[model samples]
Target chain A: MSDEKITPLIMPKWGLSMKEGKLSDWLIEEGTNIAVGDEIMEVETDKIANVVEAADPGLLRRRVATAGETYPVRALLGVLASEDISDADVDAFIEAFEMPVIEDDDDAEAAPLYEFAETSVGRLRYAVRGNEGPVVLLIHGFGGDLDNWLFNIDALATSAKVYALDLPGHGQSTKQLAGADLSGLATAVLAFMDTVGVESAHLVGHSVGGGVAATMAFDAPDRVLSLSLISSAGLGREINSQYIDGFVNSVSRRELKPVLINLFADSKLVSRSLIDDLLKYKRIDGVQGALESLSAALFADGEQKTILTEKISSLDVKTLVVWGAVDEIIPASHAQSLENADVQVIQGAGHMVQMEQASQVNDLIKEHIAG
Target chain B: MARTLSFKDAVNEAIDQEMTRDPTVIMMGEDIVGGTGSPGEADAWGGVLGVTKGLYAKHGDRLMDTPLSESAYIGAAIGAATCGLRPIAELMFLDFLGVCFDQMYNQAAKFRYMFGGKAETPVTIRAMVGGGFRAAAQHSQMLTPIITHVPGLKVVCPSNAYDAKGLLIQSIRDNDPVIFCEHKNLYAHEVDVPEESYAIPFGEANIAREGTDATIVAYGLMVHRATEAAENLAKDGIDCEVIDLRTLSPIDMDTVYESVESTGRLICVDEANPRCSIASDVTASVTQEIFSSLKAAPQLVTAPHTPVPFSPVLEDLYIPSAEQVADAVRKTMAT
Candidate 1:
């Protein structure tokens, strides 16, 4: 028996609720040399469709899971081994692979999906992972929740303690807002950190959330170790008012589906369940008013009300601004507004770059936080 | 904020929340506050299925246990509606509507129109409908089409607990009189429902499942059957879209038209009898409006034009089954 290393590309569990994913297409061919963070295949979950990136570099020896077929979480999808590994050994490895059994009882007892914290704004819902190292907080954009960082939370948690929270008026948090402006949201985030006993943390935010993170960093620089903004708002004045208005007014699945497509480069990523979940959230009482108030305060007349580029640039904290090259909601050009910050405009992605290119975004964030 | 709740509990919660929010909201029904004069438990039966079981305790005397006089109480509820009170009268079973048709169709339904828009009848008539508990003909009639046919009345039949709560809230707040049809068989069916009160606007159909091959339209308990059929058909490579027509009156023909236009096939699943039923009505509307979009003649999967049978086996067959819906979808696919 030769000591040859082999890795299995398993179906990734995106969020706490994701049980399985349909392997839609293989992006890379077998026999291709794989690098860490390389896009390997596209997987479709009930919520959204996204490309699965490689976590370990190796030779792509075999593709076991067929395209268009769904596999349970942690079920082996492909084999990644060196050229020295025999075909017989690869076949045996594939045959012996057992899909991870996720016992509902054990899982629920082990890690509760989310926790609630009573903040000054209202009751906030959050998910905390990891126990040691520096703390990192994730803030999601308008109409988003902690689940927006589904792909990144666990990855970042491998290095640092990570916390992702749904802002007031979003997710399972209170729909009543203390205040609906950007500063109001920043205060809520600060209150959440206080309730959770997080003194200082690296802030990773997306879109409106990015603006909130920047505001937190500017107000209390000592509390924010570093800032990683992904397709953030408040750096520019021009905004997709149509998308905002449509999202606010849409009451049916048909009406909301088209509006959500503006957030992703691949429109097909907006699956039926994604729209349904959003519709469910939107239908909650007081949610409509809360969203309307936020939109009015932050994005009045189809333009961003607050521009914090100068303020964020002047801050001494380490900053990283990431944008999707094809971002439609807020122009990717706003990424260049920062004078003394690292900027990365990723190609083939849109406003939701953190989700679309999750592996790259995760790597960048992990490195930035570490630095 | 959302947790699993049965349809029975959801309906109760809707009424309870509405009553708590607005002092003008009141409920009157036969045995709704159960054991009223019996000196036993004050709020005993809580309607036949205990849907309004604990509500009386929360909103005391506001939940009046009316005598078994449908016409009188229904008329009184409609008259109270014109005068500020938003009354909800539980009509027990929809089959009992024959005794109180005039109070609903002529009085409550035509209040605003006949009174030259000066009157507003914000009354909701809650009645249990459909078969499958062996309730037989008199009790398990799907009289939605009868109520929906009227000009001014808004008719709603929710399939699940979430829809039940939201639609019920909307019905209570609606200015026009509403006939809220509760499927007795689906009362125990559970789904995640938010505790807070929210309203789902009428005339907007929910796409229960998305597909590209065919479209199946249904409401009430039939929505579940249609969805099951779509899922089963999916295994056989026959993708079908299922639309839940939550409200019958002010029907969402636009949604039906959009689905049919894409899939180019239509199958309407309704628990009501076939003749002049909602199934036939939707089929006719889709065929007439988007004639060129259809690749095949639309099909209707509904109970045969006969009273609901009492026998266990016959009653099981009397209601439209998932198998029947699948067969209808398969026929459309073949065409």
Candidate 2:
């Protein structure tokens, strides 16, 4: 992987709709040791403010991508090279680096991110990734969808199959939820897995999805190989009343943005695009009432109505729990409540611990799956 | 399961079955679930006349009982359709659309073309239409022609329970926003509705009764009246073809033209007022497309250009009757 003496720093793609971004700032100067995965520069898209990390290692060389200058995705931003490589070599590499014709949107028109499979539960919408190893199903919390795993899917897909599904009444899946609750959601997930022919899968969940995953593990231990709960709801009694209330009541962007911001450590990540994305989801025909009644049913009294933490010990599955220190929605203290599970506390993260510090959380997930 | 269901029950079964069949489908309306906050029964009244009964209990919150605010909820449902949910929001009665029609005409109907094909508002706004129950102008009045004028919105006014069930289910599942006008008087009418969910696409007209002399085009409750007129004409020597224009927006003019071309005559029967009614629209379309095919001037059988009267006798005469339809068909046959 390190054969390239001249490293190409390309414009990074964040969320689904991002077409281009501005080279906002350069965090490092030339001649610095540009290690792999180091924060090389600061790129800004309309969606969020995130530090662009290096994908390869070399010495920082020519800075073709200037500060505050905008470029389309994969446009050559800068270059890095070894100390032994001469400046002439860097110039040749920069001149030769033609922006590769990145096949993105046009290519995707024929194949979409959303797919509907005729399941026993009806046509369910789900996103699948990876091709090898035991499948891992990433079930989002209340009012969440497959897009919630946009940050985690690429990292986890390297070792195993990763599936992000929209439970009935959520995402592109059908909204006709006649029998809706934790069990109903679990039934849909199990039916989807069976339809997709997954004998066993590691269940990775957030919030309410955590309850569904736990229920599945308790009900059918044979089908679940492992469990990863991030800011899960099943372990504790207390639930944030404001998050629940805001999610149910808020309909407009002005009303919903603050509520969505509560999920992250850095509220700035709650960009207009993020708010717009969530509002788009909430505006979907049946989502509001679905989330409302589901909240009342699952979190009836501002507390975890179904405490299945005790059931986790009975199931013979490798379980890992993680939490964000600054989490406002679900208390980080719940991370220690898993009696026989490995626990990690991510600093400066909120209820959405995985997204706030994706690299660290992804490392922990990979380690658990590798073990 | 396949028992003869009332028209109200047929509508419920359509929504219920479609919701069960497609997870993207959802329903919303005021009092569609009667008791939201009241201490009475949970689903006190499944719609004003009980068309949506038993769905709330089975579907839970997916069957939403909106606030008296139709504009906000209708707009929200329209907005939601663009995101992903195929929402079916009941407007209670056709009269209530006045409080919340801007969302239908400006937002839901125009989202796709306005967004340059980036959006799709697959919403279904269902409301009880047509006059007959002594429920005066406000509660009655077949307003199908009004919605039919819009380009993006698909307007469907089914005459009988079978068409009602299939067309309604299709409306809920269709990828375009739809306006479903149900005749209030037909609620008690009975028909055998299939348990399985299916769709009846727009632009397809149903031949209620076939004849060779003249073609009578109609919709909603009036389709039944047209058939009754055709039956009476059958008793006589006249053979009349009754064409039910189930969907108004994508008007099945081809069916009308084909029948008109064969019969060489046309008589349109509509419950709406005579001025700019479905009858008038059909006549205009026919004249423009197949003026040469016509043997005689098209006769429109519809109520006079006036509001629905309060008196039972006046109201009875106000609706296009079987005798009037027969007379209109006779006029076309004579020429």
Candidate 3:
């Protein structure tokens, strides 16, 4: 009868604006033995569609939420318990479970979803979570904002102070760029850390953000505790220039949707809202020029301009290189470039590996930083 | 950087930003700077509804108050546009197009074509259109069909605040004369609009809501009606895709065709009177281009062939309602 024995699977909040999601399908059947990180159900949000990975391992007792019906954030979708728990006890538990009441006033005061930081790079928009422990900065890739870590930030914040920021010319940050190359972006990140009063911390970067993180570690090794690069740039010379160019040129939703499909292994994950959000960002006055300049400076002629494998391998900083096995943007083979770092090539994911396999990525990062 | 802005504020901000960016941009209209020569505040009524309320203070001499003559002022604006000046002439009500018809259709619209590409009229005429404020038949009329019928002029009617701002900026920067129709009822309606100036390209139809059961095409304030109808239809297990044709002339028929191809049903909603209205134009185009794609005959939900009523109750019923649009959708579903 201990409450700790029952693990309730609640609907997850994927992003800042995601209030509810439809339980599209249940991947696992009732009474199945669940393991950590096992795909249990598929949830479809307006922004994207992703599978819900098990956070707690237990025997699946009951499926409470119906498939194809939407449930609010933190609504109990299912229950998992040990074999000792009876059917009546499980039924009673399901009947008694109450949905968490969302208090708008209290939640606003407790945790603001996003914040603004006035760094040397100009006004930068960022999201901060966790109150204690070592700081972890999450830098998104080109044309991406802080929300790229929507699935990973809260999970990592459980153990470490996590901050995800929009790089210049991305997200809600100032569209003006300090510089377009890796060194320029790296300098902006350092300025952000300095402004936020973070002396040294772990740096987690995705795509071009990975290049910026590496550049930071190379330029100022003492400032970086560790580095986690997921499907990152600057590892090899070959990249999907088509995606880079396509992202820079596409203006309309029809034109941009196909370009975004290349970013995921499951193209279905690129929902309508995702394309609409990107279009809204792209339509901002300076965003197009900023993205075009960055594309030319970083990936001109479809080749990576900055290669840091030799330099990163020489550094003594702890590094974890993770890549989606079927990453189309940057080949998963690039994960092998950093011989000194821990490399993990995840299967069934594309360029957006951190989002496609969020729990696994979060686990790897936690263990890497803690080690 | 995106914040909620009323359609009125969005239009004001677009003109303000464009004026700040280019010194040549000027605004001239009756009462745009209300109390121009009076003993009271100079920039008094910044347009009839204050859409241009504070512009006079910022760009003092640039915003001019003209005589009540629409023909004289519109002609002057067109002339100024051809001579390197970008002028946004406000025609208080679109129904007044009858008074300034020759200047708009003959002069500005044909300048580029008649001059064999030598002349370019980068003038924007901003006017309030549609009937929901009980402004009677004259003050409130959707005369978009008249201006859109002209070959050289670009016609834009935005549905929400975001599109209002972007399309207005585009209209100002465009090389051709653009008749920017601002719906009177949508002035108070708010949506997220970026503070920074951005131009939405012409001929791009925004799919406001995505669905599969049927396709509902609308423009201006009727877009809200169509979306409402779609939501109501959803309760009956019907899904409707609503497309907002942001611009009329050089309209985005491709987006409409794409939606109808999948949904196999079409409903065109326009606040204007039925004959030669945007609804009829869209229905005719859909029938001509992709007739086989439609599983059912296209429906046009529009005002009856009469002037907008002056009475409150009659006016409310005269304009196409969400219920009427839902009824049309139901008919399509039945087919």
lDDT of each: 0.91, 0.81, 0.92
- Per-residue lDDT tens digits for candidate 2, residues B1-335, read 12366777778888888878788888888888865665677887888778888888888888888888999899989988988999999887888887888999887888889889988889999988888788887887887878887889999998777778878877887889999988888888886554444466677777777679999999888888999999888767788888888899888888899899999898999888888888999999899998999999999988878888889999998998999989887887776
Predicted complexes: DockQ each: 0.75, 0.02, 0.71
Best by DockQ: 1
The sequence of per-residue lDDT tens digits that candidate 1 reaches over residues B6-33 is 9999999999999999999999999998
Clashes of 1: 0
Q: Write the per-residue lDDT of candidate 3 for residues B25-137, one digit (tens) a residue.
A: 99999989965565588888998888999999999999999999999999999999999999999998999998898999998899888888999999999999999898998
Q: Candidate 1: where is the Cα deviation over 4 Å? A: A1-4, A27-38, A59-62, A102-108, B36-39
Q: Give TM-scores for every candidate, taking all chains together and pairing residue i with residue i.
A: 0.96, 0.54, 0.96
Better of 1 and 2 by lDDT: 1
Query: What TM value does model 1 have?
Result: 0.96
- Residues A70-179 of candidate 3: C-alpha lDDT, one tens digit per residue: 89899999999999998888888888889875445336566777788999889988989898888999999999998889899988999999999999999998998999
List the lowest-lDDT window of 10 residues for candidate 2 chain A.
Answer: A102-111
| Model 3: residue B55 alpha-carbon error in angstroms | 1.5
Model 3 TM-score, 2 decimals: 0.96
User: Which portions of model 2 miss their true places by more than 4 Å?
Assistant: A1-3, A15-19, A44-47, A69-72, A102-111, B1-335
Error of 3 at B37 (Å): 7.5
Span of ten consecutive residues with least summed lDDT in model 3 chain A: A101-110
In model 2 chain B, where is the ten-residue run with the lowest total lDDT?
A: B192-201
- Scored by TM against the true chain B, the candidates give 0.98, 0.96, 0.99
